[model samples]
Target chain A: MQQLPREESLRLLGSVPLGRLVFTQNALPAIRPVNHVLDGENIVVRLNDGATLTSIAPPAGEAGLVVAYEADAIDPHTRLGWSVIVTGYARLVADPSQVARYEELLRPWVAQTMNGVLRIQPDLVTGFRLVAQPAVAVCAAGGEGR
Target chain B: MQQLPREESLRLLGSVPLGRLVFTQNALPAIRPVNHVLDGENIVVRLNDGATLTSIAPPAGEAGLVVAYEADAIDPHTRLGWSVIVTGYARLVADPSQVARYEELLRPWVAQTMNGVLRIQPDLVTGFRLVAQPAVAVCAAGGEGR
Candidate 1:
C-alpha cells in the first residue's frame, strides 16, 4: 500500500468535483457531499438546497461550526480503495461579491430551492489514509491450525 | 417529492452504516466519520481509529467537548432531501467497565481500530429540509430558446 503525501492530499481535495462534508449536531456526527473549490488556504462551498441552508441561514448565529471535505479513488483498477478526511470549521460567505465569485467558479450539482452560498472557514485540518496492504500472516491466538 | 419529518430524519441517520463527523479545530473546522450507535435521544459514537480518533481525544480533566454532526440523503428523481444536525460536546469514555458496554453496541462496516472510544455528548440538536417548489416563470434571453 502506498501513502499519499499531504501536498497530494490537498491537491486531490481541491480538484475533486464532489467531496463529503462532515459536521456535528447534538451528539451525533453527520456527513453530506457537496461541490467545493479551493481558494488559497480556504475552501469555498455552495449549499444550493437542503437542511444545510437552514442551519447556515438566519437563527443559527456564529457558534461552533465544523466542515470536512473528502475525496478518493478507492479502486482504479481491480477496484480496491483509499479514503482521506479533512475536518475543519466553516463560516457562511457574508460578502455577496465573494459569494458570486465562487458561485461562478464552482457550480452546485443539485438544482432546486433553498439554494445559497456558504463557506467553511477551516480551523484544524487533519487527514488520514486507507491504502490496501499486502496480506501478512498473524499468529493465531491459540496456535491451533486445523 | 417528500420531506422527512424531524423524527424520521433522526431515525434515518441512525440506520445508515457510516457518517462523517464535523467539528471545529483551533477555530478552524474539521470533519471525519466514526462508527456510531444511536441511543434514543442521544447519539453515541465510537472514535478509536483514523482521523477522528487523533483529532478529538479528550483530555483527562475535560468532561465536555463541543462538536457538531450531520447526515442526509438525496433522491435524484424527486430532487428532494432531508437532514439532521447535532451540536454537543464529545468526551472520551473513561470508566473501564462502562467503556466495554458502549463498544459492544458499535458495529463497523469496514475499518475498525481499538485505540480509544469517543462519545459525542449532545448540547443542542435540530433538523431542516429542502423542498422543491414549482418555478413561477422562466425568461430566456438566448437565441435558441423561444
Candidate 2:
C-alpha cells in the first residue's frame, strides 16, 4: 500500500459518498455513518443530533477525540480498499463566522435535519490503501474466514 | 437500534472476527482489519509487524484507539439485522501467561498464523442493533434500498 499526501488524502475522503465517522469520549468509542464533503484543509462534518456531534462535544477536558473517516472497495473476499483518517483536537464552531463558512462550503449529501455543530480545525491527516492483492493478502493472517 | 450490555457487546465483536482497528499516534490516524476475538472482557487481537500494532503501542501518552466492528445485515432495505461497536484504549501485552490463556480461549479461526503480540485490555465497550423491521419502516430513510 502506498501512502498518500494531505491534499490527495482530502480528495479521497471527499470522493467517497459515505464513511463511518469514529470518535471517542470518556474513553468510550462511538461511530456513525455520515455524508460529508471535504472542504479545503479540513474534513468538515455537518452534525445533527446524532452521535458524531454529541459524543465529541462533551465538557472541555472530556472532549479528547479521534475521528476516522473511511470508505472501502465493494469486495470482501478480496479486501481491496483505501482510507484517510484525521486525528486531532476537534472543536465545535460556535463562532458565528466559522459556522457560516462551514454551512456555505460543506454540505451533507443527505440525512439528518438539524445542523447542531460542525467539527472544524483538524490537526493531522494521512491516507493509505490496501493494494489489490490476492484475497490471501487481505487476510494478512491468512483467510481463515472469521 | 438495540442497546446491549458489556458482555453482549464483547460477544458481537468476537463474532464478527474482522473489522477496522482504528488508532492514532502523533495525531496521525491509521486503520487495519485484524482477525480478533473476545476473551472475556478483553479484545483479543493477534498482531503482525504492521502499522496497526505500531500505532496502537505508540508512547502511552500518544495512544488512543477505536475498534469498529460490525455484524450488519447485508441488505439495508431489509432492516432485518443489527450492528454493534466497541471503543476503548488498547495496550500491548507481552505477558506470556495472559497470552497463553487467550491461545486456549480463542483458536485462530482464520487462515493466518497465530503468532505475534496480542492486545487484551479495553477501557470501554458499546453496541447498537437494527431489529427486524418490515419494508415500510425500512424505507423510512427513502435511501435504504431493498
Candidate 3:
C-alpha cells in the first residue's frame, strides 16, 4: 500500500460516484451508502426527506456537522484498488439557487424524493492505493550481470 | 429498497471479505477500510502493531469500545445491491488461544505484522437491499384483461 497525496486523493475521490457517509448518531458512529459529487474540494450529496442526516444540527457556534466520507474501488477478487477518506464538516445547502444547481449536477440513485443537499468542507484528506509489488529481484540480478 | 432480516444481514456481511471500520479519534469520526471475518455473530478484524485501534481501551466499567462496522456489495453501474451496518462494541482478543485461532483464519491484505485481534459484539444490525422496481402496471393490465 502506498500513501497518496492530497491532490491525487481528491481527484480519485471525485472519480467515484458512490461513497459511504459516516457521522455520529446518538454519540455512536453511523454509516450510510450514498452517491456523491465533488464540488471543487468539497463533497456534495443529496438527502431524501426524513433522512436522519438532514436532521443533524451543528454544535453551538460551530461551522457544520463533523462527518467522514469514504470511497473506494477495490476489485473484490484481487483487492487492488484505491481508497480515499475525507474528514470534514457537512452543512445543508439552504440556498434555493445553490440547491437547484446541485440538483442539476447530481441524481439520487434510489428513487426517492431528494430535496436536501449537503456540502462537506474537508478538514483532512487521506488515501491509499494497493499496488502489485515490483520485481526487485529481477532488476538486481540484471544489474549484477551488467 | 427492502429491509433484510438480521440473519440475512450477517450472512451477506460474511460473504464479503472487506469492510470499513468506523471509530472515534480525538473525539472525531475516523474511518479505515479493513478486511474482516465473521466468527459466528461477532465480527473479527486483525490490526497491525502501532495501529490506533489497538490502543483504544474501553471506558471504565464499560463492556468494550463502541464502534461501527459496515459492509456492502453494490454494483457501481446498477447501484443494486445490499449494505449491512453493524454497530457494536469492540474488544481486543487477549486470550492466547483465541488470538491464535483468528490468526489462522484471517490473513491481512497488507504486508504488515498484524498481531492484534478485535472482536466486535454487535449491539444493532440493520441492512437494506436495492432492487429494481417491478413492472406493476403491466401485471395489473394483464390481470384486468384476464
Report DockQ per prediction, comma-separated.
0.18, 0.15, 0.33
Candidate 1 structure quality by residue, lDDT tens digits, A37-89:
88876777777554655574332246636556665444222223445566555
lDDT of 2 by residue, A1-146 (tens): 66788777777777764556666544444565554556666566677664546655642345544565554433344444666766565556666787777665544333236464446445666676656544445344454434
Tens-digit per-residue lDDT, B5-119, candidate 2: 8777667666655555655444444454455676667676666554546545642344534444433222333433445555566666556887777665554433345565456
- TM-score: which is higher, 2 or 3? 3
True contacts kept of 2: 0.09
lDDT of 3 by residue, A3-114 (tens): 9999999999999889999888888888888888999999998877436766784422457898999999887666678999999889888778889899767766675678
Pick the winner on DockQ between candidates 1 and 3.
3
Query: What CA root-mean-square deviation does each model show from the true structure?
Result: 7.6, 7.0, 7.0
Weakest 10 consecutive residues, lDDT, candidate 2 chain A? Answer: A105-114
Q: What's the CA error at residue B59 for candidate 3, in Å?
A: 11
Cα misplacement distance, residue B31 of candidate 2 (Å): 5.5
Model 1 docking category: incorrect
**Which 10 residues in a row give candidate 2 chain B its minimum summed lDDT?**
B70-79
Best-fitting candidate, measured by DockQ?
Answer: 3
Estimate, for each residue in B25-61, the C-alpha lDDT of model 3 and write its tens digit: 8888888888889999999988764367667845224
Error of 2 at A104 (Å): 11
Which candidate's TM-score is highest? 3
